[model samples]
Target chain A: MSPLLEVNELQIAFGGVKAVNGLTFSADAGEIVSVIGPNGAGKTSAFNCITGFYKPVSGSITLDGKDITGKRPAVIAATGVTRTFQNLRLFPDLTVLDNVRGGMHLYGGQNFVDALFHTPRYRKSERFYTEEAHRWLDFVGYQGGRGIPVRNLAYGQQRQVEMARAMARKAKLVLLDEPGAGLNHSEKQDLLELCRKIRDLGAAVVLIEHDMGVVMEVSERVVVMNFGKEIADGTPDAVKKNPAVIEAYLGKADEPVKADEPAKAEGPDITEGDS
Target chain B: MSDNVDTTRAPRRIGKPASRISRLFESRQLGWAAFAIAVLFPFVLASNYAMSIGTTAVIFILLASGLNIVVGYCGLLDLGYIAFMAVGAYTSGIIAKAWELPILFTIPAVVIMCILAGLIIGGPTLRLRSDYLAIVTLGFGEIIRLTANNLAITGGPSGIYGIPGVDLFGLDLSGPVPFYYFCVAVVALMVLGSARLGKSRLGRAWRFVREDEDAAEAMGIHTYKVKLAAYIFGAIWGGIGGVLFAAHLSAISPQSFVFLQSALVLMAVVLGGMGNTRGVVVGAVVISLLPEFLRDMGNLRYVIFGVVLVAVMVLRPQGFWPSRAYEPEKLDEARKGKRDGGPRPGAPVTTAKGGTP
Candidate 1:
């Protein structure tokens, strides 16, 4: 069977800058793939393109073999693709339960009339949402007041709430952008274990993480990106030994490697004075 | 991590038993108490003038509650809300006068007209961002008023007159006291309905859209559709208020639906608390009745009314009673069935983790 999410040759630009140039990656069901990149390597831009926050200038994105390229964000989300923002986009003024229930909207199973009338069906749906929200929060190990506003929670608790909110979507593919950023060491450990649990749910998981320890330990495969293109794609051990990956993360060696140099040349020539 | 960057989380407890005073102030009880006071107002001052003022306040509450759905909940600032009132009043007035139907029977037609107007106005403008939407709605409000001002069927500047009040069981409800009761019952129902909507799934969607449009979309909420739903609901509420207005006065005029009227209704929503229906109710009564109550101060009462409003805003920028993020604990009910105090006693329960043991 094909991969669950297929993003091929995705390209996006902001004025003169090519944020995501010819990036290609795929994640299969029950697999956790980590996209590790330096600052401005276009991981978020690629996420935006795949999620339809930004339309790509080129390339196609497919989920379950159907093209979802250029679809609206809501349409893409409804198609079983859900994501968490890098900056923790929980509704600050809404209760923690409401934030998680936001993800459960698609499955809430009641329309406006049912809600307005408070029919038995609406009550049942609301109950389902409430139970499911608590379940996901439990799954994410969130420790905070469920009824209070998320803005009143600690940063770590807020992060877990965001995780619970994303998981409540029950999407086939989950994209987490820097989920471990600003998390405590214990929280990071919990997040790594949570990644495995998510993958075990038979969903494809792609995470953009700056934490190498979490990425290497949790991801089944690591796709290293630099200059908006994949520089290395392999098992964590193999990728850790890739010279180009090291050079991208750290500065380059005095001598240049010629074999992998061709792939970088194929990307958009936005690096003005690289030559 | 900064000293004062809104790190307002106070670690205490979830599902804290509310105090007696706070419990009494819960939204549901507050709504009932407000309506009860409204029902009892005529007993204190049984004058026709007071009754008329009371009736107008009820209608104004309907308008403010309706606008709350749009501006307060959905975060769409509409400056042309009064246009909906004009459409409702005109539709009801013309139908009741020409076809000679009872004014109460004209409700369905008024609702239909308001929906059409909502679509015509909200469809294109909602696609624009907040500022542009506000500007376009301002223009749309004018367009509707001007359309009424020009239409000969509406009697142009003078508007339709001799409109019959609601007649129920051969009772001419046009008398001040009877009409006041009618307006109260209708406004109460409308307000209750609006509050019910505010607690529903669509209502949550509106708050989500208001808080963050892009994030709301990422969570699978179609921002455009939800926004339109809010707009239409708002129009329906305003239109129904118009029907009440026309019936109350037994006449309709273009002058009644002016930009200032829209602003005052908006002020009520802003002053009371944008998303809270009970707050909107209080805001409406205060805005409409404050000037009347201050009539003893003569011409200076307007300035005092303006000063009081400004002072309230200055003191409470969130409005008189802003919407809070406090959600009631339905989770506890679910948890009681699943988890009980058998294993972990006095262990300082923190995380609301729920799953199979």
Candidate 2:
């Protein structure tokens, strides 16, 4: 099967600091893959480059075998890629239903003339959107009030709404950034199931997670990064046994070194996920 | 086999039925209520002065509703929105005077001018978000006014005069009674259009842009183009309001497009409820007619009006009738049931790991 997404030698930088350096990975159709590392592991930077939020300094990103490098975020999104932010960005003041409907904007059911003139196409599209919005909310397992502002919901529920919004985009690849943050233990479990269910819909799922347990349990494949580079890539079991991956997490290799061994610092070993 | 599938989907079903009151308000029922009230308005006061006051109030509603699209729905701080109205007023005034055409016939020209003006102003300023955009719009408003004052076509400071009244089906709609009804009909149509647009897809895009521009873009909404759409719509709305204003006075002058006029329209939008059509209409009516009620106060009228406005702003910053968000019923009940009811089916099962995959 063709890879749903591919990134080769992706490079992103903020001034002199390399956020993502020479990273490469691919998510095949129907796979749940994860990029795990310590804080600032350049996971999100890579995701941004893939989703067109940040133009990569060098490298190529392809979706469904089609090159999509350096496109606008919306253009890339239209090519079947949707993502959630590290921080929930729900429309706080809009109704919950309206929030989900926002994701369907690209569907273009009616034009201004249709709306202003109350044409049949406008009515049909409006009805379709209303019905589809409810279906998406249900698919996300959101059992909250549909008419109230999203701001009134709890954080966990709000996260679900954000997920529903992204799901409504009906993309082929979904990127979730730290979805587990702030979610209660039970809610985290729900998120895991949600990820699986999302994958069952045949879209490739790529996530950035700090929780090793989630990485091992949910992802079919795991890519471990250290200092802006991929240090390990394989099945979860293989990545777990990789020595470089262990050192990236434990901060010390198994070998004993002399006290005077040349002190060396890696490029971007920033570790500090939002605990 | 279908039975099991239906059963599983049944539990996941979500229903959204708006409350009876909301449905009634959103439908033609509210329009009928307003119509009844409008029909009775002249009866409440038979004087020509009262009729004219009512006419002004209706026109102000049109203006406020237009501004609300730019500032309230799209969250664009358009300080120069009145410039569109100025364009419309001047365009119609010039056309009606020079060509001896009815003011109503000048509408197409007014719309074209307002749209072009919207494009010119919205194109550059929309690139800057929030505060800087506000400053640019403030300058834009002044630019339109100064241009009107300097341009020979606009009759300079003296403006234009002898603009003919609206002619409909060979009937002279020149009298106060006919003119008042005519203004009411136009305002009504504009209000309906504004409300309908607010519920459309573009309106959702506007709200999305307002809430979060980056996320909106991620949803395939072109934030720049959407913002421009809001600007152009607002300009069209204001332009129509201007046509009415010109026809009502049968003349136009640069003095009418002053900053004070812009401020008053903005005040109406804010005071009504930025995004609520009902609140905006009420706000415009109150702001326009409140001074008339205080007319007996003579010189103290302006003082009282200013004080009341300030007090309202301080007390109710959201406006007299703030727009209440329409909450989805299923989501509300689901949340309520989560606390009191049993665990929801299809709810994610948690693993030992603290992170959700």
The Cα local distance difference test for each model comes to: 0.85, 0.82
Model 1 spans with C-alpha error above 4 angstroms: A255-275, B1-18, B333-357
Which pairs clash inside model 1? none
> What C-alpha RMSD separates each model from the true structure?
6.1, 6.5
User: For model 1, what is the alpha-carbon lDDT of residue B189?
Assistant: 88
Task: Assess candidate 2 and give its TM-score to the true structure.
Answer: 0.88
lDDT of 1 by residue, B136-210 (tens): 999999999998999999999989899997898798888888889899999998888888888888999999999
Query: How do the residues A1-275 of candidate 2 rate in per-residue lDDT, one tens digit apiece?
Result: 66889899999989999998999999987789998887788998898888898999999999988899989889998888988999998889887878888888988679988888889999778766765676677677776666778887889889999999898888889999988878887888888898998887788899998766666778999998877889999998888778787677665654563322322233222232222
Per-prediction TM-score: 0.90, 0.88
Off by over 4 Å in 2: A254-275, B1-28, B327-357
Best by lDDT: 1
